[model samples]
Structure formats: structure tokens, C-alpha cells
Target: MSVIEEERVRGGVFKDINAEDEDQQPTVIESLCMTCYENGSTRLLLTKIPFFKEIIISSFTCPHCNWTNTEIQSAGRIQEQGVLYTLQVKTKEDMNREVVKSDSASTRIPQLDFEIPAFTQNGSLSTIEGLLDRAVAGLEQDQPIRKATDPVVAEKIEEFIQRLKKLKEVEKEFTLIIDDPSGNSFIENPFAPQKDMALTVAHYKRTPEHNAALGIEVEEEENDEKPGSDLDTMRNEVLVFNTNCPECNAPANTNMKLMILYVVNCEIWRSHRRAGNQNNLTDPSDMSRDLLKSETCSVLIPELEFELGMAALGGKFTTLEGLLKDIKDLIVSKNPFMCGDSSTADRAEKLELFGQKIDKIIAGEMDVHIILDDPAGNSYLQNVYAPDPDPEMKIEKYTRTFEQNEDLGLNDMKTEGYAEK
Candidate 1:
């Protein structure tokens, strides 16, 4: 071949290689900026993280108003079980640990009793100190507007922002918790291949509501039943169903007894609370019974004047002691505004006292009457004396009132539809 032809062939090969490299780089596409209502360019990069799954990172910038935003999304499917990570930040070095916080993950700081609710911020892959810096910047961004309109609120926020900055210094030990129902978030364990003493990981089964939030359709056993079935024959029958433990996702069988009365003449919804008699109220050590508190159940303690609504704790198939422990944890540790807001300081103090009383009840030190009122008639407190009625326990079943039906959203429901226009 001629020397000129050989040089042209070699140049063509290098040009093709350069084109392939350009294709692998981030793609800049036209996007509409929400801030400026102008056309912007978004650079999209699909890449895999080391020791993690694939992710897509997008950076949008608007030249009109200089608006910018960045977000990260997991390219993989949702995990089977949810995950919660608890890391104890005891040293300044811990602030440098890497973290992968998905958009669905909720973050909490136990020392400040502050929380960043899920979906409030975009997913981020950054160090602990970087997260804090982002939070501070976000808070400061709105300070000018707040100071102009409401100086009092802005002052409180400024003080809270300073405290958030101090957390990066690690002057005091604090617990950082990241809870993700999608099971995609992570915190770097400095000790790889071995367990890090400062980090604790827990896997939990996602609830039906959580599944719905993620746009997942979960198949329920109740949907298999026909429109009309034999109601009398199903009474007192122990219905066994499969479930996983919320904390560990271990397979378990939940046996539910048919205790409702659906008689032809009178429809009575059975809702029972095994209350302690005046004499037995002094001793609640043996009161640790299996409790199935449905989402519709409301718990009340008349003596303490404490009434916990149905939505406060959600559904749980745990023991009485376990339920009390959960209540304590929710109020004392997971309170979001416990430290920042001044108005809640008084309420926080009361909650701390209430937590102390709950501890006494758990330890069988307090005399309080616990009532589980379920308008839907789904809650159950196991009877220690199975076949016979216990002298210390009282059970009642009555028809629900109109107000109760309204609260349950049953009044708005039309079960027997015409299916006609």
C-alpha cells in the first residue's frame, strides 16, 4: 500500500475510538428549570458505585437564573426487606464516613431529637460532614426571607443551625439513624469484612402502607374470599396466616380467632379490652400478654389521662411490654422538634415524664388501667385463663356509635354499589 493510504487508515481508527469515549460521558439534555421557568441543561450520568448497586446521577443547571439541582436514583429494583442503620458518632473521624442516603430514607439524630423526614430531600452520596453542611446551607438559604417576615422564628432557626454545625465537630457523642423502607441506603463501615462496633444494621419487613407508598401492589389473602360466604361456620375458628417479623423479617404464622358476632337480627362488633381490676392493678407483672393492636385500635390509660390515637403506633403483633417500649422510643428518642422548637419544650418535658411512667408500667411499678379500644373490632389481648374467664379481667362487646363509624371512615363507604350510572 502507498504511505499516504496507510496514514489515512491509522487516523480513521483513532477517530472512531475518540467518538466511543465521547458517547460514554454524561449526556447533556435540554430540561425545564422549576426555579426560573426557563430552558436548562441537565447532565445525566449512569454509573455504578463501588461495593454498591448501579445509580443514575443528574445535575441540572439553568443559565437564565443560575438555578442548579442535583439528584441520585437507584437503577436497581427495590429490595425485598427494609433496612435501618444506626451509627454512633463518637469521634470527629466518624464525620468523614461515607453515606448513601436514598430519597425514601429518614434520618434522625437522637442527641438533638431531630429528624429529616423521608422525601424532604433528594438522595445523596456524601460524607457525614457533607450532609450536615448541606443541611446548614438549606436552613440558611431561607433565613433572609424568614427574618424579614418573622424575626422570632428566624432567630430560633439560626440557633438550631449553629447547633447542627457543631455536630460536625463531634464535641459530644450522638446517635445517627437512617431508616429506609426501600432498603437501599447505606453508611460506610470503616471495618470492612468485619462488623463495625459503632454501626448497627437492622432489616425489617415493609408494611402494607409502605408498599403502597412505593407503588407496589401487594397480594392480600382477604381478596381471595367470595362476595358472600358462610359467616356462622367461620366463628371461633383459628385462622392461620403467614407473616414476617417486622424487626427481623423472619417468617412466622399469625393465628387470628374469629370472635365477632354477626347475628342475623343484631350486628354487634366485638371490641374488648382486658382491664385490670382495682386489686390487680397493683401487680402488673403477669400482665405481659400477647397483644394484637391493629391500626384501628386506640390505647388509653384513664389514670394517666393518656390517650394514644390509632395512627400513633400503627399495627403491631407484640406483647404489652414490647408495645410500651415502642411508645417510649417514639416519644423520647424519635421526636423531630424536641430540641429546635421552643413551644415543644414544655410538651417534650411532659413526654419525658410520660415515658418515665411507661417505664414504671413496664416494670410493674405503676397502677394504671390500660384500655385498647378498636372501632373496627380487630385488636386482641390474650386471656391468660383461656377456657375460663379471669376474675381480674373485664371484657365488653358493644355496637359502635355513629361518631366511631365516622372516625373509621365507614360512614362514607358504600359497600353495596349499584354498578350503574
Candidate 2:
């Protein structure tokens, strides 16, 4: 009777979580093209926003190509939630209020068909007047912004720009609206109301889609199992991992997954007459699988249409990240040190530096190329749609050497004519 007591209190699991990895300082170096790795023409822009207390802006552009990408990251700790602000600009004084706009945030003027759309440029920290000036600058640089060529509409567009500039100097009626899904955007809200009209400030719950667009969303892997069938069936797109999960620190498969993910098989076909030199039985499956697994070849990662998988990091890459991590790791084995002395150590130092640059790419810290150069022709980047891979990926096919042919057992000469004596 005394031993009949059991207790239950808690219902679900309680979890302890750590903070996310802070963003590294904006980095710039001579880097290859993201769409076409033909030239190292990409540049990274990092600047601290002036008034947005502890926020930084990072952007990417390839002067040689048509690639423009930008992002705004908080230099401070994580925000608990996001906020939105709306201001009715009826007088000139309202234009001087401090404003914070992240790269993903969208700005609008309902009265006029004018807005600086989200993800357009490196995010800016400026007053309302400054933002308008930026918008004007953008239009001038862009040669293809279609507008109503009709005289009336064209004149109106020009008038809108003019009003935006005179926002601080002359009193006018316009609505300055800012919507930031990241909660990083802000309009000056002093504790004391200085005017008869107060700024409308609201805090709202951020949806998953909004979080993803801002690069702060967290996700767990659902189906990471080895895929079957052709890896490149969907336009040659697949995530090829060289290291374990970069975010989760998952264990590496050590290239075990390569055999099943194949494009073409290379094999030896013995001559019917060269019975003395060859074994009687042949297996195409075995040869193909062997070609995929045994041959030493480079893997080429082209510019992916989707964000290359970054479940390891909380935020995903837009255009600056790729599968360069695996490519760089593969480089070590091929880029060996020749047996020597001081020269070898020097080479190792340079290689280490090069690897560091590659790591930046895997972290989405910068943009670069992923090149795998294996002479065997058996290795592939897996799931490449075209022979050229992406616009930037480079591929070279070499004639197999006599010794290489012999190693693969392809040197048979006497099917109907000549056998080596």
C-alpha cells in the first residue's frame, strides 16, 4: 500500500539553445565570377551604417558581369522580434527623422509609382532625404528602367523626384512608408513626442518566409539520405558535401556517396581474339561503378539556381555561397607537396592561405569558384545539367595516356585485326 505512488510533472521537452555565429567583417579580394568563373572580377563592400547604432552593410558586385547582390546585418546581438514604421509626411520637418533600411526591406510611396524595392542595393542608413537621393542615383545608372514615355507621365515622374528632394526644404504632402521584415529597419522614435503628430510604430510577428528572405531562419534537415536515379535529373542540381554538415558538424561520408551518383561509366572492352590476355567474363555495371569510385577526377560546382544547401548555418546564401568547401578539401590531395626542403614548406603555407579563402566562400562570406581537376575523367561534381556545368564552371577533357588505358584494362588490340605480340 505504501509503494503505490508515481509522479508526473512536465509534459514536453525543454531545449537549451546557443546563439548563432556572428557575421564576419565584410571581406574583399580578387575573386572569380559567380555566373562564369572566367575572371576574378568580383568585389565585396562592407561599411558601418552611420546612425543605425551598430549595424553593418555588405554588398557584392562583379564589374565584369551582371551580378549585383546586397545584404544588411546587425552588428549587435540578436533581436527578439521585428518592427515596422509608417510616417505621414505633410511637412518638411518630418523628412529629417533618422531611418534605418536593410537590404531586404521595401520602401514605398503610394501616391507615386515610386519605390526602392527590396534586395536592390547595399542597404543604407540615412535620413528620408538621403534615401530619395539614392533612388534617383539608381535610376540614372540603370539604362533599362521602363517608364511611361508619354509626356504627362514622364513629367510626373520627374516631379516626384523633385518633391522627394525638397522634402526637407519645402513642405509637401507625401507618405514615406518603410516595411522591414527583418525588424532591422527603424525610424527615429524619441521617447518624448516633439510634434502634434506622432510616428506610427508597430511590432508584428515575423513569418517563416519573411525570416528566410532576411537570412535568419532556422531549419532542420528532413531528407538527407543518398538520392537514387540520376542525380542531375532536375537540371543537374544536387548538394555535394565534401565535409560533414558545415553547420551541424556532421561526420563526413569520405566520398562513399560518389559511386551511386554517376553520369557515365568508363570500362575496358577486350578483343575477341585476345583471349590469352583477358578474362572471359565482363560486367558493365562493375566497370561503371568502379569508374565512378576508383578514378581520380575533379568535381565542378557551377552557379546553382537555388541557394546551395546551408542548413548548417542559420541563414542561407543568396549568390555568394557554393559547394567550394568540398572542392577545396579535394584540392589538398591533388595539390601535394613535392619531396624537398624549404620550398615545400613555403608551398604548404601558400596552400593553407588559399584554403582559407575557400572557407570564406563556404560560409557565404564571399563569392568564388569551385574547380575539381581530375585527369581520370571519372570524377564529377554530381548533378551537373550541362557538360559545361554552370556558366562559370570550366571543364577540360584530356586524351587518356597509354599507361592510364592499361591501368583500366582497356589496351586490348586483337578483336579482329592486331594483337600486340
Q: Return the top candidate by lDDT.
A: 1
Q: For candidate 1, lDDT tens digit of each residue in 256-354?
A: 987744422223322322221221345675457777888777777777766565554678899878887887775555442233321145556676787
**Which runs of model 1 end up more than 4 angstroms from their true locations?**
1-23, 50-52, 222-421
Error of 1 at 347 (Å): 46
List the RMSD of every prediction in angstroms.
17.5, 27.8
The TM-score of candidate 1 is 0.48
Model 2, 12-37: lDDT tens per residue? 11111112213432356665667665
Error of 1 at 344 (Å): 44
Kindly report which residue stretches of model 2 are placed more than 4 angstroms away from their true locations once superposed.
Answer: 1-53, 57-73, 76-78, 143-156, 166-170, 190-196, 218-421
Candidate 2 is scored at a TM of: 0.35
